[model samples]
Target: MNRLMEFIATGFYSGKLPKMPGTWGSILAAILLYFLWPTNLKFQLLIIFITFILSVISADYVAKELGNKDPDCVVIDEILGMEIALLGLSADIKTVFLGLILFRVIDIMKPPPIGFFEKLPGGLGITVDDAVAGVITNVILRLIGGLL
Candidate 1:
């Protein structure tokens, strides 16, 4: 169980890399989005919700084991963030790239409401900020989609 949690938290050991584990996790998420993407928004939301629950559980355990608040290696947050960011967006290269960039930027910037989520306890703190970033990205994409 611990090993499984570690596997999940680490983004399949992409987090074990020496630097920028979150980025690696996001990359993994992109790959996953490419392959396992759902046919509709309802299924997408269900997938994200399940991932959210599992990520929180795994992230909390992994963070505790690592003795850190939001340890860099526990990048389940990044996966959730990317999933949310790309929600309803097409799986084309352009959409994926834009979503990835938007998500990473918003996540890094951590502005306002997004930043606020970081203060929550345990895995919520570790994950919600990123999810908020993804939401912001979704809004941005919606605006772009509307403009086009």
Candidate 2:
């Protein structure tokens, strides 16, 4: 149903919050990650894969319903991206919060290929950029963590 898809796409309506819905979704994701993050890397990857599929489907449906490309009310991408950003990291408050900030920045800035991925059609476009941002953020975090 549209309602179900909308709910998922909107990151359980965090995307409907005033201003920076993407950020809200990411915040929710970070909180979830902090509390529920799995210790196993395989489990983490499985969760990301499942979320990615759901995000793509739900985001595409919502985009078609709203007749807009990457509408503000669709932020499952942010959830997916946040997961990717924090992937494999120890789920501590500091790391989770840092990952959230890095992901939001990279996502907002849309640097390099991130922007390019956003140009894709449908849900793929909606989610790929955030995924890319997450990858970039994850790498940055790893490098930073390595330095410390």
Candidate 3:
């Protein structure tokens, strides 16, 4: 069970990378978002819903197991964050790649409410900040796309 939690939490072990595991996890999440992306928007929403639920549970357990409030290697948060970032966007190179960069930037920056959410309890703290970052990135993308 621990092994499975570890696997899921690590974003398929991308989190185990020697450096910048969060970055690696986000990269993996972007690639995953590309492949898992579907034409039906409902399926995309479902994917985010399911991944978010799983991320919360697994993140909590992994934190408990690893004895860290927010273990760097547990990047289910990144997976869900990236998923949220590209929610309504297409899987094209521009959308996926740009979303990756944007999400990473917002996630790393953690401005205002993003940092506030990061201070929440346990796994909620770990995931909420990234999720908000994704949402912000999505809004920015939509706004930019609208102006174009």
Cα lDDT over the full model 1: 0.87
Give RMSD (Å) of candidate 3 vs. truth.
Answer: 1.1
Give the whole-model CA lDDT for all candidates, comma-separated. Answer: 0.87, 0.93, 0.87
Error of 1 at 44 (Å): 0.6
Candidate 3 residue-wise lDDT, 23-135, digit = tens: 99999988877887886889989988888877888888989988899999988899888888888788888888989998888888888789899888887888888889989
Worst 10 residues of 1 by lDDT: 89-98
For model 2 the local lDDT of residue 38 reads: 98
Q: How close is candidate 2 to the true structure, as a TM-score?
A: 0.98
Off by over 4 Å in 3: none
Top candidate by lDDT:
2
Q: Relative to the unseen true structure, what is the C-alpha lDDT of residue 146 in candidate 1, on a scale of 0 to 100?
A: 87
Clashes of each: 0, 0, 0
lDDT of 2 by residue, 1-148 (tens): 4789999999999999999899999999999999999989999999999999999999999888888887998999999999999889898998999999999998988899898999889999999999999999999999999999
Positional deviation of residue 136's Cα in model 2 after best superposition, in angstroms: 0.2
Residue 6 local lDDT, model 1: 95
Return the clash pairs for model 3, or none: none
Weakest 10 consecutive residues, lDDT, candidate 2?
61-70
Error of 1 at 41 (Å): 1.6
Q: Write the per-residue lDDT of candidate 1 for residues 42-144, one digit (tens) a residue.
A: 9999989998998888999998998898889988889999989888888777777888888888888788997679999998889899888988898898898
Position 3, candidate 2: lDDT: 86
TM-score of structure candidate 3: 0.95
